[model samples]
Target: MHLAMIGVGYVGLVSGACFAEAGQTVICMDVDPQKIEGLRRGEIPIYEPGLEDFVRRNVAAGRLSFTTDLNDAVDRSQVIFICVGTPSREDGSADLHYVDEVARGIGRTMDAYKVIVNKSTVPVGTARRVRRLVSKELARRGLDLEFDVVSNPEFLREGSALHDFMQPDRTVVGVESAKARQLMAELYRYWTEKKFPLYFMDVASAEMTKYAANAFLATKITFMNEIANLCALSGANIDQVRVGIGSDSRIGDRFLFPGLGYGGSCFPKDVKALIYMGKTMGYNFNILEATNLVNQAQRHRFIFTIGSFFDHQLDGKTLALWGLAFKPNTDDIREAPALTVMERLLDLGADLRVYDPVAMLEVQKHYENYPYPERIVYAPTPEAALEGADALVINTEWDVFRQFDVSRLKNLLKAPVVFDGRNIYDPAQMKQAGIHYFYIGKPIY
Candidate 1:
């Protein structure tokens, strides 16, 4: 199968490369000339685990390629995946300018029968709009070329994108025509063979399903964070409560880990977009509203923990930060809680020493405006971050940070105080090491 992927962003790149690795010839198209040139040379722009190896291997095998010509991609491939970004506007609506532009571009360039798949998460009814655009453009060219629009949203998590792509829990296909379904089934033959059910539904439900899944997960995290806060005040432990409640098969634990909060490209934007869409229909989403409130409060609460630890005299406190990215094993900083912690601590007059496995350079790009790089240090290692620090605050749960030597941490820091935002270690262990530890849903010890 010859496949064309428009927009070589995170999803497009990973999906296109992985498809090529699965024996399909893939041509990735992008508007940016520099990005296309880099891809031609096998230079990946994003930092994802195992992605570079996947891209390099497929490119070496001649199954994958890159280009900037949209018409050529349209002419060569029978299936096209639209995997562009849909960032949120200030009013919390998903800004579909990029997706719209690509749809229009596809309408103009498409030559023959092709399955135009929506691989990016978009608001409902986008597939109809895409179908209209392509139809209008084909009419304009006076070529009655047939094309079918399908919704095939991705469920790839950032850290484990390759794994998720290879072993998806399920594959969704939204199509109005049996022809589109057959083409999609043929494309996903690899997954279908392994019994990953391909759900065929109308376009609207498929679009709504992606937003619903992400928003629900975000709500779960927000609810747990709120419960964790109440637990801290009521002399209860969230970890224990989480385990006890999660024992139920219905409430099985997955995203229930209480922490600074849920932050990434998907959850925050999708929640707001859903609420915004509801408002456009004159409905207020009360549950989503509360979820947003609780998530915001969780960040401030974590900051308060750090402030209370220092008795609000965080002024001139040299704090060591263990993680920079929102989560571990990826360099993505979009909506990261660590950035919120950094800003609040800086405003309160604390200096920061930060370290992460992969997000240091990404953080530096945004924090280049810091007037005190002298005060805000970027450590090469976790121990280097603790050099002469007042205390240690854990943000992302990198494997090394989770298993750091307690004695070394005590010897390196000026104080043995730790604000464990992720609750990675047991309170008993921190207590046994003679370290002052403050964690979510648990009292300071």
Candidate 2:
């Protein structure tokens, strides 16, 4: 398969690399020349586990390449994947201008039959919109080109993107024509041969599936957070509740762990986009609305608990903060709870020493224009962040943070007090270690 992944962002870069590794000839195109040059020089823009090695190996094998010229990519590929970002607009709908631009470019440059796949997570009916845009552009050029638009939404997690791509639970492809369907099947024959499910449906359903999956997961996390908050108020343990309920065959444990709430590039944006879509169709997603409100409140609730512990006197406090990325194993900080916590703490006149394995540089860039950038010191290591700090705060549940020695943590902190947002540590263990511990949805130990 000759694949052209337009937009070498997180989705495009990962997908292109994976396809190349699967023996497909892939050309990843980006509008940014600097990014294209960097990729050509073996510089990966985003951090995903095993992505750099995967890209490098494929590039070395001459199966993968990068370019800034969309025309070149369009001309050389049989399957063109629109893997651009569908960022959330002010109205909470997806901004599809990038997708539109790519569609127009493809129509202008494509002289033969091509399978144009929507690999980006977009709203329902975007495939038809892309088809219309392409037809309009081709008509203006006085050129009649035969092409098919297919919706093949990607269901990838940030930290485990490569694994998700290679070992997908099920691949959903929405196609309108028989030709497009056969081409998609042939493209994913590697996974299909391994007995991984490849589902074919209408384009709208495929688009809806992506949004529905993310929204439901977001709602599940929000529900758990809600239950955790109630457990705390009612003198019950959320951990016990989680296990008891998770063991039920109907409610298998996944996204059951409660924390500062769900925050990532996909969940927050997808949920909002779904809600907006509902409004547009004269329908109301009441549960999703509550989920959004509760998720945001969960972060503030954690921050408020911290403030109350200090009797609202957070001034002059030096806090040790762990985790800057939204989740573990990825350097993406979009909508991360750590950002909310840090901003609120800074507003309250508290200085923070923060550390994440690979996200410190991102955090530094994030705070470049902030009023109190100096107050948020980027620590070299987790232990270094804890040294001489008033207390430790865990935001993201990275594996390294989970393996910290209790005695060492106690000795390094000015006070042996810890506020665990991710509930990484057991309450009994913290109690036995003689450390004052606060965590979500549980009695303070």
Best prediction by TM-score = 2
Write model 1 residue lDDT over 275-376, tens digit each, in one string. 998898899999998898889889898899789878988887899998888888889999999999998898899988999999999999989988877768
Q: Against the true structure, candidate 1 has what lDDT?
A: 0.89
Cα deviation of 89, candidate 1, in Å: 0.5
Q: Candidate 2 — which pairs collide? A: none
- Model 2 lDDT per residue over 1-445, tens place: 8999999988999999999999999999999999999999999998899999999999999999999999999989999999998889998899899999999899888889999999999999899999999999899989888899999999989999999999999999999999999999999999999999999999999999999999989999999999999999888899999999999989889999999999878898899999999999999999999999999999999999989888888899999999989999999999999999999988888899999998888989988998767788889989899978988999999999999877677888999999999999988999888898999997643
* Top candidate when judged by lDDT against the true structure: 2
TM-score of each: 0.97, 0.99
Give the Cα-based TM-score of candidate 1 against the true structure. 0.97
